[model samples]
Target: MRRHRSSREIAAAVFFAGLACATLGGMGQRCLPVAVVGHLCVDLAPRLREAAVLEPGRLFDVGPLGVSLGGCVANTGSRLLELGVDAHLAATVGDDDLAEVVRAAALRSFGERVTLDVEPGAGTSYSVVVEPPGQDRTFWHHSGANDAFTGGTLPPGDVVHVGYPSLLPGLLAKDGTPLLDLLRRASARGSTTSLDLAVVDEKSAAGQRDWADLFARVLPLVDVLSPSLDDLLSALRIDPGTTPRLDLADELAGRLLGWGAAVAVVSAGAEGLVVRTAGRERLERAGSALAPRAEAWAGRRFRRPVIAPRRIVSTNGAGDAATAGLLAAVAAGADPETAALVAVTVAATVIAGDRVTPTLLEDLVTPAPTTPSAPGDPAAGAAPSAPLLLPANQPRGRFYRGGAAIGAFRGTGAAEEFTPEDWVGSVTCVRGEPGIGETSLPDGVRLRDAVAADPEGWLGAAHVAAFGADTKLLVKLLDAGQRLPVHAHPHDDFAQTHCGTAHGKAEAWYILSPGEVWLGLARDLDAETLGRLVTEQDIDTLLGAMHRIPVAAGDRVYVPPGVLHAIGQGILLAEVQEPEDLSILLEWRDFELDGATDGHLDLGFPLALSAVEHSARSREQVEALLTRADDPGPGLPVAAEEYFRLDRHDVRGSAELEAGFAILVVTEGPLEIGGVPAPAGSTLLVAAAAGGLTVRGNGELLACRPPVAR
Candidate 1:
């Protein structure tokens, strides 16, 4: 008679099969996404009354009024997206006529990523800009829906652009729910933020003071803060008269930097611009033609422009355009000098045009190609790459092993198919097994079982002896499978006395294949009701109430001691755990492992009851533990603790390993270990003894370390 496999067996079989397929295939890399906030404002240039006086009854015709979306939501954000950046926009608007106009404009410019937060009866803001020659432009502005903009209207963005600070008074509300507070919240999640101050009148000086304090508070969190010299001096209360002429801009930049900006740029009209770093400043003169003629100066001297533009028109949004250019370059990982150059180029282009488009800018801007070069080259001009360390073939000294073995080599040897029977009887986990041994690990580490001749020498004799006593987690990469039991493990306090162990099981995984995984606290009870569930053998009801999630490869799932969880089919993963095996299985129905009742590992009924989690589960709470590799590239590091520090190292050619003790486990390709070829399934023990090793070759490696406390 043929025997039917248990649910655990079926699940294990499917997992391993899927894992094999993933080993042969590759996953695509992802980039960091971006988001923009604030409302789009249409600036009406010709409608201004000042234009009427300049043109004198000619209907104040100012070059077709140059209609386009402005504000953080449009100008800065749209430019980023057009530069191949993954960007989104979040802005408040009225559901009225202007809302439709702005919404349609945003949709046409940014597509679906633009989110319009609409409030009834609110009107979208608009501005009338008048350039009346020989002075800064005058603005007639209205803050419609913008005045009602609140914290709840904010959206998620990696780098937020808070534009036109004067218009965002609600953002500076004295109440705790300030919009700036919301921005702080977003920035706390690894997002960088920036602010743009508009030209304001002296009459609103008190309002300006409030805005200055707001800037001071938010500036520390901001990566870059760009404001014109005139606007900054007015807001900061710095009297140009009192300040010394020598290094005045440098001093101002230094103060701003001290407030937490990485860098600052001050634009001085006609005098050109000054970019100050932490230690030095670079001044780029205005284009030569724009500079005052030498003969006209009569002993007075003016700086000459480094590069002259072919033509010039309006400088209306030149600063804004330059700001967008600098931000875009920075977002693309360019260096400071390159970013500044890009900014200057962008500003010049905007000055020459009535309006700018992504296509036009892309066509005009030429980015130099970046290439990988040997380390220590000053002109190598690329972001530093990971180091490469070759492990020595011979031991530098005596090798000792007392640390717990987190990973091991399954074996080496190319095989066409993997069977349970073949794996069940294998004594040595090494190369030449019935599994693919050529594929690499997630990081740059290589894999393969230790040879029989060196098993004790490689894994330590003591480690092998304690294999039975120590918790053993078996990971079977699956292509298909049945659902296993929903379960939890006793807490450390309960386990020490009841199970003769101090630690309870807490495991996490990095999924290698995409599929559904069941997880959560088993019982549907609140914290108050948890004690009752534990008193009763309500395993079936508890498992039924837990949450089930469908996950994909490169996704991380964490299971705390009290969370009842089980992985479904089609997943290959690396599981980390505490050194204990105590568990409480809540579901046994449809399970075939060890006759459902006979061979299953079970916690005593009393102890099992004590382990039930009785609080309401939150999706956010769960996701906080699971790191998904949607953006920011493949083989990303998601989880870290003092107990263990884990990172995924993805390499194309070569990468450096930091100078510290870390175990490099190969999750993907054959890696060169100390000039020796080590295939997949091998775990190289990189000790502090290996100090500053170099890793070269293509593939991925998972670097693991003992919990920080150790």
Candidate 2:
């Protein structure tokens, strides 16, 4: 009978298949796109007919109002497209007469880059600005569809700029929740955003409070916050009149940076603009034109003096134009200083025009060169550079080993030292042995044999011990007679099934002495010979088949599992192995001990025979051991994987082991760890948890640890 598949099995297969497809799909698609949001507005300005005398109840006649595009949506959006950016504008417009006009204008000007969403019954916004004379303009703004704008209208883009939130009352709702949500969505889509502060009606308490809280929530997400000096002063509640006599623009920029802007550019009227980034500020002045021949003859030629335009016609949209120029320059990859210059030039052009005349402004627009000026160039001026800080107590941009710097603070006279407290701990040892006898450590503490202590410290000390926990091989230092048997270990599967253990012994040895060793498959044994000898228990014949090589200090040899090998007498080494003890002894001849039951080896006969790699045991195929003549005795012998790395340090005279906790083993002369005396053959297990202390001693200290794996 056919049965239904279980939900668990079906889900598991589906999840793994989907994950693989997603990983492969992501590897093929990568690109960058930009999104611009905020509603578009039509600005209508009445042409000045006649100057009105200042008197009560007096009305002056004016020409018919002219309609034009306004807001950051029109300026920044159009400028980005003009600069050939892949920028898409997302905004809601009224589905009325004005909407048709606005859509037509945006489509004609922005080509396919403009995206307009029509909201029914919503009137398209239009501001009727009237400037009589010598006074700030009065705006008759009609907020139509923009009042209902929400985060749903914002499209994904590489960069999102919220032009004028003041026009949309919905943006200033409560905590400016809608605006914050839109900006957050853009950020989540990996877009860098900028928010331009709109004009606030500060006469009312509600208006002032709303703007203050709005900027607080807005500025944090903004990467480049370009606010006019006056707007910042209003938002920060700083009284410009009572502040200490200094460059207010520079001070405001500094305050904004401290408040968490990656970069801040403040436009300071006649004083030009101040650009601050990475804790350094620079002043970018307006560019001056060379004096005409007539002016030059009249001694009016100034020496590189930045001058505002000679005539002022219309100042209404000058700031917006300047912002457009700056954004355009940045989108085109201009530096902060160069972008500031371009912005000022654009502002100067606007002031020199009657209306927002694009043709005349373009004629007057002179952009700073794209190429960066060389250092010390007169045009670039001398700006203070931010100091480069280095890691702990070390000199800036310098490499260090011991007794070097740790952390460094730029502009502050503070640095930290790299010491033992900075590291986990160090390793140290005394004598040298290849595998069994020599004492070692995981980090700083001494390694003890399991049989030596009831509660073995080194056995379960590390997060993962070098050897298998169930293995029978006990690491020990032999001062007298102790020869290991010639044996091999079964594979994990075989050992688990027959020997009641889960691991097999695949071990390697690091020779720490000068001694000759016999290793590899039995001597005079081919595949057939070894197989026959293993079944017959011909211990002597098998031992004779193995190869014997002279191994010196700092030599390494690999002994794979199921390979019959043994450490010859007089050889000492450090052994790293899969922690397991099952061994199949193949040799038992000419020893002053019982050969049978009493002193016999457990072969795990059938299991070992099945798991043994006959090809790897050949004499010619066995790898020869490598030894280093010049050994840097255990301190931290480079990081390793097979458990730990061991380092050996040779110290002469009275040496300070710095102020830190370290395990000091007195292999030679007397040494002191943490000021406590440790004589020869004494193992001082220093506690790293105790913090830093002093280690003073006289002798060669061998520091051993697991080898660092690649």
Candidate 3:
């Protein structure tokens, strides 16, 4: 029987495969180079109102003119760079003043990989992009230097991408012989040949040629062909009136495959990507980078729907971004489904005005690392051996208010608005976000990277043996300026089964200021009624339904997963929880956030509400979850001991601390730990290698650690 592979193993296999390909020719190169050869230009977009008057000689006030690089070399190449690929530009520009602008923009990311053939006595290509509010963009383009391009001097890379063939007049001069030769040369070098097309303008001279003949001649040499649906229809001179988009895409992809291409990827705007591949024999010939996974890639067809962003900016480069993602994943040996998913994900980042990263792509292929450590880990030397100070890591753009308390506590002056939580010593990021909520050390290293690099050194041998590099803990200082939105988190079972995550959120709070907090259900209620109450935005009933308890400084409260709770205004606390940011908000009215859109964690209300605890908790049971900070032994209740451990050490004169991987927050201190002056409000990370440490001073210290690794 064939051995089954876990997601982690698959991710590791693909990552190593990509690593081997990255060092092509054994010259010790770290990144695989992808050559983007075609159509480079400058774009100047001036935003106008929806009803702007545009008569011949009339001038209207508009927003700033956004000047940026355009065409395939910029859109697709820059996107590839953002995905951590080394994209080399092999295009042309005229020897004019505008060439400097193109050079400046392209060199910022592509660096020396930009090989611009300066065509003397010709003007550089440019486009005036007219984008009105809530309308598709229109371009006034000048072919300029692009008309003189001959597809010569292609960058020496593993993949050669010829983009926007419809815009290159020279390539279309002789039945696309020049374009055909370019693909042949690239294929002869064992490099993967990819092609992309622009929408054909029937009135243009290049567009008036036989495009079907051109594609037929060149596609046999092409391994990957990505084209927009409309472009494909226009190039082939075919029209399908009222045909379902998926069916149309299927028909076109099949035609492309039949024409001898290894794979055809069709972009249907917001409908996402449609992918079709040839059988194993042809797939094995796709390229060295993709051949190893030919068995998985062979004869596959699927459509990946777009994962919508929180807000849509301009849909300008969404298609190119999708192509970049598809190519990068293919080079990394991802299967068709995963490649399509990465394609859509990258497009969504472009829509949301965000940049893509390799970490984001890796998350789609595997969960966080949680397997046992290997023999002789390579990253152990990079782990922290001594305690490091963590600067304030308060993320902005929260719906709630209040950061003054956190700002004062961390000794950081003048906190900005919407910055409410300080994630201290955190190795986890916000849900659906890879780099946002993680903590950074003083020297600009991300805590997550450090912990991942040396799990044994940072997390201890036993912890690494059990939990891999997963810190399994998140520490935060949340300052609630206004009453928090009623919310609940799913437990581990629901999170893993339905949410595709490793941990659910079970949190405990160490109160620093007095406030009234809502906890647990006041009475038993059915799931249907609970859903109804949430849908109606019945704030009064929702708050009244939970037991309200007063909390003071030095009080500890344990909040289990699935329990609905809210922190009252004017409360400041240090919290520890499972390393996740999964919250299902029950109410968001009167807050800056839109509850109807964002409250459900992307799982619609009906399904999300099922994760809530509907059974009532008696007053006695609720009280049992709380404990005084001055209580004997552990700081929190016994139930929380399984998730995390918080210990308060009171120092009258001096004390000795048992060293481990933990976060130390000086609660009330004008004290010193191992000769470092840890005054009130200082936070420090203690690595296990630090061993037993001597603490001297008169104050209180709270050490937060992950649950004992069993």
Q: Which candidate tops TM-score?
A: 3
lDDT (Cα, tens digit) per residue for candidate 1, span 616-659: 47766666667786746433234435224556778677777754
Report the Cα lDDT for candidate 1: 0.49
Across 1-710, the per-residue lDDT of candidate 3 in tens digits comes to 01234576566557645734543323222333577889989998887766555599877888888999989888998888776676667788999999999888876656655778889989999998887888777888998999988787666556778889899988777888788767755654346788988888888986678876766777788989989898888877778799987789888999899888999999888776689999977865565445445667789888878899878888887888888887776665567888788888988999899878655555564211111223332122355555555556676567788887886665433455567888888877766557778875532356777677766778889988888888888889999989998999999999998888899889999999999999999898798889989889998998988999999988999999999999999999999899888989888887877777888878999999999999999999999999975577657898998889888888899988887788888888777887766767777788776777788889988889999888
- Over 368-399, each residue of candidate 2 has an lDDT whose tens digit, in order, gives 23223344221222111211000111111111
lDDT ranking from best to worst? Answer: 3, 1, 2
Model 3 has an lDDT value of 0.78
Instruction: Give the 10-residue window scoring lowest on summed lDDT in candidate 1.
Output: 282-291
The alpha-carbon RMSD values of the candidates against the true structure, listed in the order shown, are 19.3, 24.9, 21.6
lDDT values, one for every candidate = 0.49, 0.48, 0.78
TM-score of each: 0.47, 0.41, 0.48
Give the Å error, residue 557, model 3.
Answer: 85
Off by over 4 Å in 1: 1-33, 47-66, 132-136, 150-157, 175-180, 205-215, 237-248, 279-309, 354-710
Q: Which stretches of candidate 2 lie over 4 Å from their true place?
A: 1-34, 50-59, 83-86, 133-136, 203-213, 236-238, 242-246, 278-307, 310-313, 354-710
Q: Of models 2 and 3, which has the larger TM-score?
A: 3
